[model samples]
Target: MKVEKNISLLPYNTFGIDAKADLFIEYYSLDELRQVLKEHKGERILHIGQGSNLLFTRDFNGIILHSGMARARFLDDETVEAQNGLRLDDLIAQLTDMCYCGMEKLSLIPGEVGASAVQNVGAYGVEAKDVILRVNTLDVETLEERVFTNEECRFGYRDSAFKHELKGKYIVTSVVYRVKPGDATKTREEIIETRNGKLPKIGEVGSAGSFFMNPFVPEEQANALLAQYPDMPHFETPQGVKIPAAWLIEQCGWKGKTLGGAQVWPKQALVIVNANHATAEDIIALAAHISQSVKEKFNITIIPEVNYI
Candidate 1:
């Protein structure tokens, strides 16, 4: 276990926020994690992964936990169990190298295995839930391990039970993913190329991937919007008509637009980047402006996918 006090969080988050934390702990084993939890029983604790999907609004005043146990092992020919600290993309790359075919579409997505399960991170029509078989977690109160099957996770578009009813009650320790024997190099390469072209490179640019979730509107409303803009893109699903938030933001003339030190990514309007030493306030203000414009133009309210810490 490694513990530090009053540390800069710049290296931890992909957004490059310079926030500080009162306490930062990195546990290398499940036993160490349990010990930490037991020691800080009633204190506020936040378990973070790569911090890719988060925006630290201010210095954290409580414990911030991270895992240093990154490893993956094949459980059988078709399943693999990966520790929480393993980078999701790194695991995918390794699997692809070994000719695993299930997770190629998710290649290059930022975040770790635990956050993948918590956020249900998705891309190119594939979601973590689609490939995840089970999630191994630790009950915060009891310090006992528990396993949840995929269906028990109750996954929704880019969301899961971890973000809601079960929030803070359990900490995901590892995830088991289903795979098959097939060369996925081509698909993985294409995905990486596509993402690299559209999304900002991590470390080079500060961003939290997609800033907003695509809005789902009723069929009638979608038809109404389509009438006004015939070229509008949409898809019908069991939930509703899913309209890409990127298109909505672009139509509202937000592409490449800047506010304070933040800017809407030119290639992908779905992303908000810290263009030049942007403060959390600048990013939040810019997101609010974009959301308001989209809401004004179309009666749909787009919500942020990034969590503000």
Candidate 2:
């Protein structure tokens, strides 16, 4: 276990916020994590992953916990278990190199293995829920290990139970993902190239990959909108008609637009980038304006996917 006091969170979050935490701990084993939890009982605690999807609004007056255990192993012919601290994209790269095809579509997505299930992260028609077999977590109160099946996770579009009823009650320790033997090099490379071209590179440019969740509307409303925007792109799903938030933001002339030190990514309007040392308030204000414009022009509400802390 490693402990630090009055730590700057600038190195922790991808947004590059310089927030400070009263206490920060990184545990390398399950026992270490349990010990820290017991020692800091009743104190404010926040568990973070790669910090790719977080926005630190200000200094945190609490304990920040992180996992240092990074490892992965094949459990069976069809499953692989990975530690929570392992990078999600690194795992996908390894799987693809080993001729595993199931996760290639998710290549290049930023975050850790633990956040994959919590966020139900997806790209190019493939979601982490589609490949996840089960999740292993530690109950915060008892420090006991528990396994949740895929069905029990109750995954939805970019969400799962971990973000709701079970939030803060359990800390994910590892995740088991389904895989198969097949060459996925071409697909993985293609995904990596495409994502690199549009999304801002992590560590180089400060931005959450995608800032807004794609809004879904009733079929009737979608039809009405289509009559007005013949060029609008949309998709039909069981839940409703899915409209890409990128398209809406672009239509509102947000692409390449700047507010304060933040700017809407020119290549992909769905992303908000800290192009000029943007503060959290700058990013938040820019997103609010974008959302407001979309709501006013299209009567659609687009919510941020980034978690503000």
Candidate 3:
């Protein structure tokens, strides 16, 4: 278990943020991770998957463990197991090739399978929790291996028990997904149509996906907004009516707005992209500014979906 010191973290994160870690270790297997943990017992450890959803605020003093054990295998006709480091897009591609259908809705979401379960990542009316059968995790307190069923995961909108009650208490090792065969041509067409209509074209530019989760407000609040702006779009969720954060941001005239090297994507207000040499601070500040503007103008607060480390 070799550990590097004072490692630059810029290459690790998707935002291309410049940050450092005092101690960094990349694990290729579960045994390697256990050995490292044994050697550095009682030390603070941050588990990082692909670094897509993370924003590093400053240099970390403790160890940053990068899970590089990228392995994916089909368990059965309807089940696939993937290591924590397996990229979400890779998994989607594999499923697509196999004619599997459930993951198509999340085709372009960045990050690893482990992080998807952590946040119950969702898009286009589908969520990770919907297909996850079980999650393999290493308990931090006892160092015991356990499998958590979907129900045990306690999934919610852009939230899971892993993000709150069990924040750093467990290290997810792998995820098991239940999928079924589908018509490949039809699925491909659907994906193409959705992308063409709702998202930026491939290779267009920079982004960490959607910047904020659509804020769920009371029906009354939504109706009041509808009264003022009758064409405002909203969708009903299990919680309440979810007003698109992008629509609200667009209404605030933030789309195509640039701040330093960061810019609200011209194509999607829900996305704040790094247009040039943008730093983590710059992106964060722009998001805050947008949030503040929306809150002050519409009396609603927009919460970021991206995780800050």
Candidate 4:
């Protein structure tokens, strides 16, 4: 429950942005977090796990709670339980070794287990909500532990109840995922094939995955765009057609474009990478410029998937 004052946050975030926090503490257990919360009763708090999905806007004025406890175990024959602090990439690797197929698509996504369900993080056709059996949370208001089922999570396209109704109301402690046991070699081969002929590598660069969620547009609008660019990728969702944000961004000539020390990845238009010593403000400005250009050209406003604190 020890709190450090005026902590530098340069290494905490994936963007490597320089920022500071008035109070910062690393909690290794739920009891430690409870005790700290009781002692600092009136302080504003921000819970962070791996700090992948966040951008610091300025020096924080409140407490920063870093979830540092790491634990994972097989709950049963078809379920695995993991603490909030477990890295997403490590979890995926372990699951793949165990012949669990559903999480391989999310192999390269950054962040911890706790943040995955918050946005229903997805890639290549699969989403976190698709395999999550339940989420264990500590209610901030009542300080009670509860397990929410997948349906209760209200998962939508890149959204869930955690981001809407329950935002800032609970701290996710752990998650249970439903997975299957099969042949590891076959699963690895399938995943490798689906990677667009790329090798399986980790920690290649600084990124938080796709910066923007794919924009959902009406069928008519999607059809118009499809007619214009026959190869534009899209998927049919219940809402309408989910158009790839990368397509619009590439069409607008933003790929490989650099602003200050931030640049859109040349290979993946959807990813904004830290080309050098990029500041959070630099990345934010580049994203805004890209979004504005896309909107002006395509009449669609792109929504960022990353959280700005």
TM-score of each: 0.99, 0.99, 0.93, 0.92
> Judged by lDDT relative to the true structure, which candidate is superior, 3 or 4?
3
lDDT of 4 at 110: 67
| Candidate 1 lDDT over residue span 87-188, tens digit each | 999999999999889999999999999999999999889999999999999999999999999999999999999999989999999999999999999999
Instruction: Specify the poorest-scoring 10-residue window by lDDT in model 3.
Output: 198-207
Off by over 4 Å in 3: 189-206
RMSD of each: 0.6, 0.7, 2.1, 2.4
lDDT of 2 by residue, 1-309 (tens): 999999999999988888999999999999999999999988999999999999999999999999999899999988999999999999988888788879989999999999999999999999999999999999999989999999999999999999999999999999999999999999888888999898999889998889999999999999999999999999999989999999999999999999989999999999999999899999999999999999999999999999999
Whole-model lDDT values for every prediction: 0.96, 0.94, 0.85, 0.83
| Candidate 2 minimal-lDDT segment of 10 residues | 92-101
lDDT of 3 by residue, 1-309 (tens): 557999998777777777999999988888888888777788989998777778787888899997887788989988999999888878888778877878888876778888989989887678999999999998877778999999999999988899988888899999999888885546555765776675544335456678888898999998998999999998987799989999999999999999988999887899888788788788999999999999998899989988887
List clashing residue pairs in candidate 4: none
| Better-scoring candidate (TM-score), 2 or 3 | 2
Summarize candidate 4's per-residue lDDT along 18-126 as a digit string, tens digits.
Answer: 7999989988899887777777767888888777777888999999987887788998888999999899778888877767766777765668999888878876678
The TM-score between candidate 1 and the true structure equals 0.99
Candidate 3 deviation (Cα RMSD):
2.1
Candidate 1 achieves a global lDDT of: 0.96
User: How far does residue 231 in candidate 1 sit from its true spot (Å)?
Assistant: 0.5
Residue pairs with backbone overlap in model 3 = none
